[model samples]
Target: MPAAPTAAWSLAEWLAWQEQLHPKSIELGLERVRSVALRLGLLPARAVTLTIAGTNGKGSSSTLAASIYREAGYRTGLYTSPHLQRYNERVAIDGVQASDADLCHAFLAIEQARGATPLTYFEFGTLAALWLFREADVRVQVLEVGLGGRLDAVNIVDADAALITNIGLDHTDWLGDDRESIGREKAGVLRQGCPAVLVERHPPESVLAVAEDLQVPLLRLGRDYDFSPRDAAWRWQGPSGALDELPLPALPGAMQLQNASGVLALVETLRGKLPVTPAAIAAALRSLQLPGRLQRVGACLLDVGHNAEAAEVLAEHLRSLRPAGRVLLVLGMLADKPVEAFARLLQPLVSRAFLGGLPGARGLDAPVLQARLRSLGMETEACRDIPEALRRALAQAAPEDLVVVTGSFVTVAAALDVLHE
Candidate 1:
């Protein structure tokens, strides 16, 4: 589109300027990005790339994998999307966020290289991250797909191993309205003859068909590999072998075992290239942390679970925690999410729910979400914003009771901001 707003701008100015270039915020396709990437040599050449795509566990799985790689002494480059609080959280090299100066430099280079090619904000950020990772000469690059696997900007690079965490009915408008259609779109990340890991216990036939058609050596959960919880820890059995007495993930959720299992399978798939010791795996599991996914901040527990599947996971986590008192919920959801389904899953666990309005196109109003919960026969309170909702939830909860701020990432982010303040 038009030239960048100004020259020699800061990261904030550059990000705001980039957002203006694309007509739509999220335009999914690779042609425009691929052309610019080819010009800038942004594709991964030397590094081992692992592309992760899913509805819920993608963040945790990617974090586990990247942390293990980092623990193994590899220069790890990770690129995730839709940062909760800071844009800088999206790209990191060797466990450090890319500096604002570094991102600005990369943005300036892409701005010059793209010419008339109108790149979406995500496309530009993806290219910049790849370029930064390449320039840094990182040995292991983990890219999380921003949306559907096929058309997501990160999928432009042919990953050495593709990890599909699990499929759910989120992003139906862009990806299809059902799990099978979503699975087919996610299965696009699988490459012929390359190793692909599907950690979903019951994967869609479309994904299996795509893997078969592409001749992808698929390692599926339950069939190819599985994990079972022991008293305290879990045991992972894969094609490579079984690893017993593994430490539970430190991410504070029972569902993390499922995510960690996929991570372990991917580790096994890439072990030939980047071998990690059992010690490293154990260490990574014990040390791994991801914010806004069942994260605990002071007295408030925060989860960025916007869909029904994620709500199921959150419910499981809350049950495992076994809070002795009431579990008050401060919730805010996007307009497109299955608010009723999510509410149904979590309502039983929640003693009382406070609804808050999130801002932007996808956000649902607080009163609207409160009415939805009330319709579900749940106790509800409506607040103007996440801060107010969190305040009310905390006020309602006793010291023994748990206060959870959840629903969408924006909700968690808002809670975090208010908590930090």
Candidate 2:
């Protein structure tokens, strides 16, 4: 085995070392991670745990849940994956990103405990977050599953409540090919007798079967819980009661309502232990901020929507906005994603596309994306990278036009760096 990182090592050095520590970057199984957690005594976290799993809205839903708990005066921890800018974004306490010194300490602890066992980059991060959360003495922890829930590193903790925020066809290679198989994998987060919330009105049978077989107290949207528009505000009705005149979520898009409703249901299940008031819910919705989800900066909008489902939602949101001028797109995607299908979904709304090359082995090149868009009969320009794409798109866009930056998280991160500069 390679030498472990020392206490003096920086967070960036530790992260770089971890990326090459394991044989496979993404070997999805619990045995290795669970064993490490046992050694670290991170199992059975003292805090109330809410594990969120889904292809699309896991980030938004997890953020919403954690914000509500924090607003209710709890020291909350949130762990999410594929961060846009920095590694620190993965583990947050009370809405603040974990500090480099804290993360380095956590990494050292895990390094000393793991002996000869090898851990993937993601596994190391997950264990580190759990250790930090435990040390912080958080009252609640919201864990967003890194991949399919069954064996995702975050699933090591049997959560008090599990929320599946509408599964779709994503990570098909690792999870499965179809929605049924994907749903089954996501459903693995649900524990027996624990409450599970489903945001999808008509979830796949596989998800429902797992809940039924486990005898999970399921709260499903449109059945057990639902949301409706009330003027500029909205109302959420769940098994417990109704929360009326709630402010629309600060997160844009109609899909946020679906995510908010499921979060409300999950919050209701934990009321006995957490006890979040209606005011906290309203406050959280009005103030919560999630980066790169239709996030607007002047005339440019940035979203990390890489798949067909996300594309559909983005298209819907764009239509609702009704931009006075054409919608210009800057897109970069991983090689594994369904670029053609994703592009087709937004083809009608997009007047022109500026394609760019993403980094890493999985990132698709700009020329490849150009060919895909051309096949769809859409006008396209291929840029060397996302920053160039954003620049060219912005330079060409009229004042009334909306410039959209999207595809993978990496794409949006690059655009954000340029915008900040």
Candidate 3:
């Protein structure tokens, strides 16, 4: 199914135009985007772009890296997928989202460039980001892959640096189930000799083999660099490098430590050329924030972790925060995911689970999902939607108690609109 159109030529016109071009939200093969890119001349001929791909933490890692570079005083551009509150959030320069006028220029450019040929919504946005960044004369561009990297649209532009954070089971229908298969697919972003940074404690051998075959500069965590705790702070050391004591990332959770390390390794690899100072790194992590990733909203907390691996990360963070009273969860997820795994992750941490149907054809029906909550063995209520779920949860809780809304980004955003009100 296609993403339903919701833009004016204003936002709507461009959205409707692009939606008609592509048959699917994701066409895994890169050939169409590559051809259009050549015609549109969208490919970067000469620019230092750091492309990142991973199942989780891609946005956080990109934010941290961009923030550090910006703090160090470089003109940096960041591109991430699936914006929460606004489409503008996907493209940013120095932490500011692109304005609607900028988005208009990009949409028009892509429309003219494509001629009669169609591009996916993601493809259109990728071209727009490149166009906007080039026009703005950005010093660095960090492009996060939207889906599996092997044939994702972003692969059209080769990278000066490529970082693959971690491999996990996701988009299983497109990629394979096994870790090694997924790792090999992700290794697609690596350029022949460009530096590729990885944080896998045990990276799949397939990824290592691909890197070896390509002679890519392999920077592995334990072998090339390592991060470990040092008293109250953390210490990171790279091959031919060491970053002294650093504070924990303000992003919260133990998973962020690994992500922070990856950010450091990438910056460290480009040190003199990128020239980021330790003070800049400290400031970025201390101030870096991404919406709806274990994020606090008024007295309620919201996160966009639906899959089991992400759920595990959310669980660990909740354990640390340990909100003052009994925990309450307002949960919604796609029907295809392991709903059981996510339910288990939250059931242990919260006192009651408020299930709801997310707003999409793929969303799991709330009442249908309720049966899965039985294993949770906790009090559960099925709400009509995210807003209703939030109303129910908030009415039952005191200001200090936990009211968590988790599952998908759509769920978080819908609830966030109410949380802000």
| Residue lDDT tens for model 3, 125-242 | 9888888888888889999999878798889898888889888877777888888988889999988988889978898898899899999988888888889987678999888678
Rank order (by lDDT, best first): 2, 1, 3
Best by TM-score: 2
* Cα-lDDT of candidate 1: 0.90
Q: What are the lDDT figures for the candidates, one per model?
A: 0.90, 0.93, 0.84
Off by over 4 Å in 2: 1-3
Q: Is candidate 1 or candidate 2 better by lDDT?
A: 2
Clashes of each: 0, 0, 6
lDDT of 1 by residue, 65-126 (tens): 99999999999999998899999999999889999999998998898899999999999899
What is candidate 3's TM-score against the reference?
0.95
Per-residue lDDT tens digits of candidate 2, residues 129-203?
A: 999999999999999999999989999999999999877888999999999999999999999999999999899
Better of 1 and 2 by TM-score: 2
The 10-residue segment with the lowest total lDDT in model 2: 1-10
TM-score, candidate 1, is: 0.97
